[model samples]
Target: MTELHRIAIDTMSGDNGLSAAIPAALLFLKEYNDTALILVGDESKILDELRKHNQEPNERIKVQHASEVVLMNESPALALRGKKDSSMRVAINLVKDESADAAVSAGNTGALMATGRFVLRTLKGIDRPAICAPIPAASGHTYVLDLGANIDSTSEHLYQFAIMGSELATAIDGVEKPRVGLLNIGSEDMKGNEQVKAAHKQLQDGGFNYIGFVEGNDIFHGEVDVIVCDGFVGNVALKTSEGLAKMLSQEIKAGYTKSIFTKIAALVSYPVLKSFRQRFDHRRYNGASFLGLKGIVIKSHGGADDVAFANAIGIARKAVIEKVPDKIEEQLQKHLVD
Candidate 1:
């Protein structure tokens, strides 16, 4: 039998309450044979929600009580200073203390990022840690880093992100020599803002398969593997992509429901449409890994539903099994593509 990983998950802070995370946890546990979950939250609330699903947070899943709750409006430092007993704090401590292999949370993102760096700390040689989210592309998915973690990211910071993201693509996603690209305004090699232009020049000279600059439109085209950019630019790109996806989806829904004939046609194309919708779904990339941290810290969408929260826990388990952080350190030392 394979070894089961102990994953700590925060249940109190997502847009959805224990209602969503608990059920999703139950669903994932059913599929994963070699994994145990430690849920950190109001124990009674978690247990009560579990009972709602005719289950309990028992041995396969354990509960740790957290009294303080971190609100979304709280500042990163303020939340960290006072809410020591918050679910996010308890979850991070599990990995920091060797109690769990990784930690997953759907809480105040700012607090999670702050507490993760403070408690678990960054890996050696990594000036700043980054968040890697799988962006929708043609064939499968490509990863983008620093998606709002460090808004004022420097050029050296982006280079570090490239190293981190490439290793992840190869190790976890099985993408070898992941074609890297510098996110920019134009496809031409010598275009865009100074930071992007400089980063492009540096990557072009680097050891990886640096594939020049990729425009904003190429994100969904499946053209690149790892996207390199400062947090300010990367965050804008991510939000724009997400917003466009949502708007398109809503428009499609309206068109389909506009009339009885359209609804009938929609039923005929429902399966194909469903697949298309799932194709660009952000929920599929619900958890964003805080790469370069000593232990795994996955940040889920604060507004994530139950399905999203459960998927976040699943990501943490995968990181533990794949030995992501250790692999990141190993790959950072050497620039091998494979």
Candidate 2:
């Protein structure tokens, strides 16, 4: 039998709260034979939702009570200290205590990062954690890092991101020597600011598969397996891509049903259109990993629904099975931490 992955889920702070999370958990359990869930939240509410879905708290589906819920707009520092028993914190605690292989949350990004850092802490020799997620590309997918985990980072931080991202690409994406790209405006030698330029030098000599500097266009080309940048730039690129995908999807649907003749044509081309849509669907790419932490933690979009959240759980499962955190530590030790 395949080994079961125990995933702790913070089920109270997402857009639909327990309604979406409970259903997502059920979906994950049904689809992934070797996965179980610990639904962390108010026991009573969680049980009610489980019953609504005709599920009971069995061995595969367990409920761990966490009386409080973190607000979406709550201050991260305050929530980290004041809401010790919050669902998000409790979920992370499951990983710290070795009760769960990984933790998944669709909570406030800042609060989740703060609470996770506090509970799980960073891996030794790592300065800070980075939010890394897979972005769909033409040839394949590219893993981008620092997706709003830190606003300002130094050159050394970017170097560490490369090491961690390289391991992530290898462990999860199955790339042998993942090509690392430093995000910049121009691919020329002296194109970016001082920080990026400094990082470029380090990556060139650091002994990884450094692919020199990559522009934003390189992200979709899938020319590089891993893209490294500070959180500020990474966040902007991530959100911009998401918005563009949404706009393109809407435009395609709108153009297809414009008239009777167009609708008929759309019917004929429906299969191809669907294939294209599925290729760029952001829901399939819902989970982001908080890399550099001692324990595996996945951050789902706060507004994620059942299907999106289920994908998040899948991300956590993959991270656990791949032993992503341990791999990052191994890489850090192999290539001296900056």
Candidate 3:
């Protein structure tokens, strides 16, 4: 029998609250038989939502009532102070207390980050945790880090991102060495700012599969497995890619339905178009791992629907099964000693 993994879900944080979260948890349960969930939110609402789907909380699906919620627009500092029993905070506490192997939240990103860091704390020698997610590239998916956690980071921080990212790719993507790169403007070693250059040197000698500087375009080429940058750059790249995907999907739909002839073409090519669309569907890649934390925390999109939130739960399960944090700490310890 497969070992069971427990995940804590913040059911009150997303835009649709229990409506979205309960269904997602059900969907996850239907698929992963070796996993259980702890839903954290208002008990009454969660129970009502579960009954809507003809479901009851079994031993595999338990509820932990949380008294409050951190609003999407609330400041992280303010939320941290006032929302002691918030669903997000309680979910992280489950992970911290070892009741759950991992936690997932579709809440205020800033508040989630702050609460996760505070509750789980960073792994030994890790200054700050980074937000990392997989992006669709030309050949396959590339895992990129520091999506929006630490806007400003030093060379050492970037190095830590590389180490964590490499371990993630190795464990999740099944890559042997995991080609890691430093995101830069140009390919040359001297083509970036001071921090990028310093990180470049650090990665070059860090002993992993470091493939020097990679341009923004290289991100989609799929040649690199892991790309490291400060939160500012990584977040901009991530948001820009999301915007482009949305715009392109919209334009394709609009263009295909413009006229009768185009409509016929669209019908004839529906399979190919759908395949292409699925390749870049953002929902399929909704979760971002909070790397470097002592425990696993997955940040889902605030507006994620049932499918997207289910994807977040899937990420949390994978991280727990792979022992991602322990692997990262092992690598970081080796680097620290050298």
Candidate 4:
């Protein structure tokens, strides 16, 4: 029998709120036989939503009530102290107490990270928890870390990010020796600032496969499995990539519909275009893992739809099943002892 994995979801959070999360939970339950869900939110509203779908809390599904809701623009400190009963916090509390294997939230990123760190705390030897998410690449995808969790990271922090990211790739992608790269301005050894240079030196002697310095363009090359950088740089790179993808998509659509001849050409190339779109769909990569925490917490995009939110739940399930946090702690211990 498959061991059951329970995930706590912040149903009252995100842009679409229950409309997206409830449907996503239903979809996820239908797909994953061995996993259960605990929808965290106002009980009455949750029950109403389930009733709308002709469903109720069953053996595989449960409800946990949270009276408060965190606003999107709310400050992290305010959300942490002022809203202890918020859906986001309650869901994370379930994970902290081991009542659920993981927590999934499409809430404010800052509040989610802050609450996660304060509640679950960081694993030993990790100074800060970093946001790690998958980015579309040429082959499969590359996991990039410190996406928006820390604006300024020291050399040791970058080294820790590499270790956590490498282990994440190993667990999720089944890559034995995932190639790790330090994101730099250029590929040359003399290119980056002192922090990156120091990180490169530390990673060189680190146990895993260190691929030296990688430039920004190398992210989509699919050669490096993990790219390490400070949160500020990583967040900028992520947003830029998202913007570029959007622009390219719009441009392609515009070019394809300009004339009758192009319209016919679009018809001919429909299959290929669809395949490309599916390959790089941002919705498919919606979940971001908060690494270095003692437990698993996945942050979905605030405006994620049902499909995107379901994908985030799937990520949480994967992390739970793979024991990602435990593996990360073990890796850190090994590195520290060495």
Candidate 5:
């Protein structure tokens, strides 16, 4: 039998409260009885929210009370210290203390990233663990690294991220021999800045399935399963992609609402379009593993709704089952010196 893995979650800081996230969690809990969950936040409110769903806090539905909730606008460090008992902090400590196998947070991303890095610490041989976000693409998903985790990185770091990202795509995206791509300005061998040029050489030398430099235009073509870049560039690429997806979606909706005829057509096509849009929604792709952490720490989208937050919980559970952290350690252990 699979041992039940405990997951600690920040209950109060998502776009919606326990009302939505809890129900979705309850769905996961019902399906995966071999899992234990810890909801860290306002005790009374969480209990009440659970009660609304005809459930109550119990042995499996554990609670770790936090005296305060970290507001998104608060400084990451200041809030972490000043609000010592915030939900995010409590959730992190659960993992730090080994009370839980992993902690999933859809709170202030900056706080989650900062606190997780500090509290859980990095594993040996890791320079810095980057955020690996799922890039919604034409063919399933591709794992992109350093999605704003580190602003800068050395060629060695990008090489490490490429390895990690490739591994992740194999596990999560189910792509074997994930074709790795270094994000660059053009397809030519000599077309990028020093970082890309350097990373490309290292990736080739490192024995990864390097697909050469992929331009921004190729991200969504399902061309590669893993995309890597320094955090400075990767973050901008991710945000720009997200913004474009949103704008295109908005324009489609606006066009549908422009006329009664269009509205009628939209109404008739609601199910298909909704399903299509769901394919590209950020909410579905919210959970990004903080690769190189000792334990599983999934940094969710800060503005995630209940679906996204709940999806993060599922991602955390899956990470534990797959022993992703252990896998990362195994791979990196070779690089660690005496």
Candidate 6:
């Protein structure tokens, strides 16, 4: 029998709360036979939602009661210091105590990061943990790091993000010597500020497959395996890309429904349009891994629905199976010792 991997879900933390998480858990359980879930939230509410779908606690599904729910706008400090029994904190506690292999939450990004760092702590040789997630690319997808965990990062932190991003691509995507790049204003060596330039120098000699510098456009080129930047820039780029994708999708639909002629044209192009939609659906890439943590934690979008939340759970499952934290630690130790 395959070893069972358990994931703790903060069922009370997302925008849709139990509605999204409960259904997502059921969907995920149906797909992964060797996995179990520890749903962390109000026991009564969770059971009620499960029963709505005609589900009851079983050997594979367990419930852990958490009295509080972390609000989406809750301050990180408050959530960290005050909401000790919040679903988000409880879910992360499961990881720290080794009760669960990983934790998945669609809560406040700041709170999740703050609580995760406090609870599991960063791995040895890592000063901070970075949020890493996949962005759709031309060839397939590219993983970017520091997606809002540490808004202000130093050159050393950027270098650390590169190492962690590279290892993640290797472990999760099965890439060998993943090409890593420093996000800069220009592809030239002297285009960015002090931080980017300093990071570029460090990466050149850092021994990984450093690809010099990559601009914002490079994120969609699929040529670079990993792009590393501070949390501020990465977050802006991610949000901009999301906005652009949404605008383009809306424009496409509006254009297709403008007139009877266009409506007929849309029918003719339905297959191609569907393929495009499926290829670029943001829901397919819902999970962002908290890299450099002692344990695995995935952050889903707060507004994620069942499909998207289920994708987050799948990400946690993959991270557990690949031993992502161990791989990152091993690489960090090798680099630090060298």
Backbone clashes in each candidate structure, one number apiece? 1, 0, 0, 0, 0, 0
Ten-residue segment with the worst summed lDDT in candidate 6?
187-196
> Could you tell me every candidate's TM-score relative to the true structure?
0.94, 0.96, 0.98, 0.98, 0.94, 0.98
lDDT (10s digit) by residue, model 1, range 214-333: 777777788798887777777898998888878888999999999999999999999999888777667778888899899999888888876777777777777787888998898777
lDDT of 6: 0.94
Q: Write the per-residue lDDT of candidate 5 for residues 1-338, one digit (tens) a residue.
A: 75678998888775665655677678778767888899888898888888888888776888778878888777888876788788888888989999999988777777787888888888777889899988877887778888888976887788889878877777675677889999888888878877778988878876668888887767788878888988988889888987888889889989999999999999999999988977877778878898877788887676767677778888888888788877777766654431
Q: Which residue pairs clash in candidate 3?
A: none
lDDT of 4 by residue, 242-302 (tens): 8988899999999999999999999999999999889888889989999999999999999
Each prediction's RMSD to truth: 2.1, 1.5, 1.1, 1.1, 2.0, 0.9
Q: Worst 10-residue stretch by lDDT in candidate 2?
A: 329-338
* Model 1, residue 284: C-alpha shift (Å): 1.6
Runs of candidate 3 exceeding 4 Å displacement: 1-3
Q: How accurate locally is residue 198 in candidate 2, as Cα lDDT from 0 to 100? A: 98
What are the per-residue Cα lDDT tens digits for candidate 6 across 32-151?
A: 989999999999999999999999999889999999998999899998999999999999999999999999999999999999999999999999899999999999889998998887
- Which residue ranges in model 6 land beyond 4 Å of their true spot? none
> Over the stretch 232-284, how does candidate 2's per-residue lDDT look in tens digits?
99999999998887888789889988999999999999899889878877789
After superposition, candidate 1 runs with Cα above 4 Å error: 335-338
Ordered list by lDDT, greatest first: 4, 6, 3, 2, 1, 5
Candidate 1: worst 10 consecutive residues by lDDT? 329-338
Instruction: Give residue 12's error in model 4 in angstroms.
Output: 1.3
True-structure Cα RMSD, model 6: 0.9
lDDT of 1 at 249: 84
Residue 305 lDDT, candidate 3, scale 0-100: 95
